[model samples]
Target: MTIQVGDRLPEAKLQRIRDGVEVVDTPTLFEGKRVVLFAVPGAFTPTCSERHLPGFVEHFDEFRDKGVEVLCMSVNDPFVMKAWGESQHVPDGLMMLADGNGDFSRALGLEMDASGYGMGKRSKRFSLYAEDGVVKQLNVEAPGEFRVSSAEHILSQLP
Candidate 1:
C-alpha cells in the first residue's frame, strides 16, 4: 500500500554525495524534524530539471522559514544526482538524495515502472510534509501530472 498522511516513513538508507558518497537513513533523517520531501521520476529529465527542482529551490527560503528541511529524491545513483545538483545550482539547504536501488521508494510504495521510457523502477512525482518522521500531508501526482507536488503547492500546505 502507498504510504498515507499519518504513516511514519520507513527506515531505509538513501545516498548523497557531500564530501564523498554517504548513506542517510530515512527515519533518523526526519526524526524530530520538520521536512518537506519531494520525489521525481528521474534526474535531469525535462520537467524535473526545469520545473520540479527549480520550484523547490526558488521556494526553499519559505520552507526554511517555517523550519522545514527540503529534500529532493530520485531513483538515480548518488553520482548522477550530485551532478544534476551542480548543474542546476541547487542550494545547500535543499538535500539531493539518491534512492539508488529504489529500496526507499519501494518501501514507501512509490516506485513506478518506467521501462517504456528506458528507465527501470523509478519513483513517481510526489511531495510530502512530515514531522518527526510521521507524514502530516502527502501530495502524490497521478502519472504525468505535476501540479500538486510543486514546492509552491507544498508551501501552501505547510503548517
Candidate 2:
C-alpha cells in the first residue's frame, strides 16, 4: 500500500547537491519541521519541467511564510537536480532533493516503472505535507495526471 496521511515518514537516504558538492543520507533534513515534499518522474521531462516544478517554485515563499519548508524530489541524480534548479532559477528556500536509487520513493511506495519510456524506475507524481516527520496530508496523482498534487491544491488545503 502507498504511504498514507498521518503516517510517520520512513527514514531513508537522500542525495543532494549542496554548494556544488554531492551529499547523501540526508533524511534528517526534514526532521523536527513542517515540510511539503513533492516528487516528480524526472528532472527535465515535459510536464514536470514546464508545470509541476514551477508551481512549487512560484509558491515557495507563501509556503515558507506559512511556516512550511518545501522540497522537490525526483529519481534523478543530485547533479541533475542541482542543474535543473539552477537552470529553472529556483529560489533559495526551495530544496531540490534527489532520490537517486529510488530508496526513499520505494519506502513511500511511490516508485513508478517508466521503463517503457527508457527512464527506468522513477517516482510517481505526488505531494505530502508533514509535521515533525509525520504526514498530515498526501496527494497522489493518477498516472499521467497532474491535478491533485499541484502547489495550488496543497496551499488550498493548508490550515
Work out the TM-score per prediction: 0.98, 0.95
lDDT string, candidate 1, 5-112, tens digits: 899999999999988999889977899999999999999999999999999988888998899999999999999999999999998979999999999999999999
1-159 per-residue lDDT for model 2 (tens digits): 689988888888887777665565535766788889999999999999999999998888899999999999999889999999998889997889999899899999999999999999999999999888888989999999999899999998888
Model 1 ranges with Cα > 4 A deviation:
none
User: Among these predicted structures, which one has the highest lDDT?
Assistant: 1
| Alpha-carbon lDDT, every model | 0.94, 0.89
Worst 10 residues of 2 by lDDT: 21-30
Off by more than 4 A, model 2: 22-27
- The best candidate by TM-score is 1
Instruction: Report the CA-based lDDT of candidate 1 relative to the real structure.
Output: 0.94
